[model samples]
Target chain A: GQQVMQIPQYQHVQEGEDFTTYCNSSTTLSNIQWYKQRPGGHPVFLIQLVKSGEVKKQKRLTFQFGEAKKNSSLHITATQTTDVGTYFCAGIMIYNQGGKLIFGQGTELSVKP
Target chain B: EAGVAQSPRYKIIEKRQSVAFWCNPISGHATLYWYQQILGQGPKLLIQFQNNGVVDDSQLPKDRFSAERLKGVDSTLKIQPAKLEDSAVYLCASSFQTGMAAFFGQGTRLTVV
Candidate 1:
């Protein structure tokens, strides 16, 4: 059994402010995926990070994985109203236990315009 | 390519009632997953299927919940004598393989009185 914990359960900021959410897993993960769920909408795939100490960026969002592969973070710069949603991190367990993916509770974000 | 599809966007039932949800994953995806998402929480994996075979059902409440992917394409999840805690969104996702990121469907929202 594995658990992934995410910090900052709720965040509210002005439209142009920056925001970041952190995730840590109880066990080392082989890979981690991020998803976003809008209000009243289903979750949407965001990105995936593999390889230790990896960093990836999309437009205004940046994703990073720790060297130990047990922690990750998502940072959004100059957020907009459209960025309001819940961000989730899912960690894939190692040892190939039939792809056991454990998900974090999520970070709910509200962008105030 | 079409995304994962689900039926009956919403449902409402009393406690101890039975209900079912349907999902149609992507055409070529080899892995399908069912997740339950409560309000303000991330999705939790209920079951996973690999080509009509049950790969994981560790988190599923077997006493009242069951799922099947007979043809490896469409799947159904059933809950008999559901409890009030079963009021949540049932989400379906599909991936090309066991280790990849997944694409999710809109999800079925269920409410129990």
Candidate 2:
């Protein structure tokens, strides 16, 4: 069984500050994806990282996959009020037969203006 | 193209009652997944389906939870004799391929009293 863990279960930041959430998996993943969920809303697809040591950016947010494919991170620069939400990481194992997806517990972010 | 569709955005039932949630994934999507998300936590994978076939149900509580995807289009999740801990949001997502971006539907929020 694969398990994904996230750090900083809760994070609070002021406007214009930066925020980052880390994700770790017990097994080597073939690919990792990130998602965001606003309060009282459904989860939305954000990004996916496949190659090891890969880095991708979207506007003010950056996503990175570890070289060993066992971890990932999401960093948001200059957070705003609208950036408040929970971030989740899902990992897909390389040798998974049934395509089991393991999701991290998520990091809840709150931004104060 | 339509996104994943779910019925009964909300539900409230007694602890011993049974409840069922329905989901219709996006057209042409072969992979479907059901996740349970508790308050203050990320989505947990409950089951996955690939064209009406069960791919993964390792995390599903088999004693009380069951799900089915018929005709490879629509799916349903059932919880019999539900417990208070069953209060959470159930999300349905679909993807065109494995390890690809998944689009989630508006979840069904269930409250077991």
| DockQ for every prediction shown | 0.74, 0.81
- In terms of lDDT, the poorest run of 10 residues in model 2 chain A is A93-102
How much TM-score does chain B earn in each model? 0.98, 0.98
Compute the TM-score of each model's chain A versus the native chain A and list the values. 0.96, 0.96
- Inter-residue clash pairs, candidate 1: none
Reference contacts recovered by each candidate, as fractions?
0.70, 0.83
Model 2 Cα lDDT, one tens digit per residue, B22-110: 99999999899999999988889999988988888888999999999999999999999899999999999999977888999999999
- On residues B1-113, what C-alpha lDDT tens digit does candidate 1 reach at each position? 99999988999999999999999999999999999999888899999888898888889999999999997899999999889999999999999988798999999999999
Off by over 4 Å in 2: none
**Candidate 1 Cα errors over 4 Å, as ranges:** A95-97
lDDT of 1 at A87: 94
Per-residue lDDT tens digits of candidate 2, residues A1-113?
57899998999999999999999999889899999999999889999999999999999999999999999999999999999999999998654355666789999999999
Score candidate 1 by TM-score against the native: 0.96
In candidate 2 the C-alpha lDDT for residue B92 amounts to 96
How far off is residue A54 in model 2, in Å? 0.4
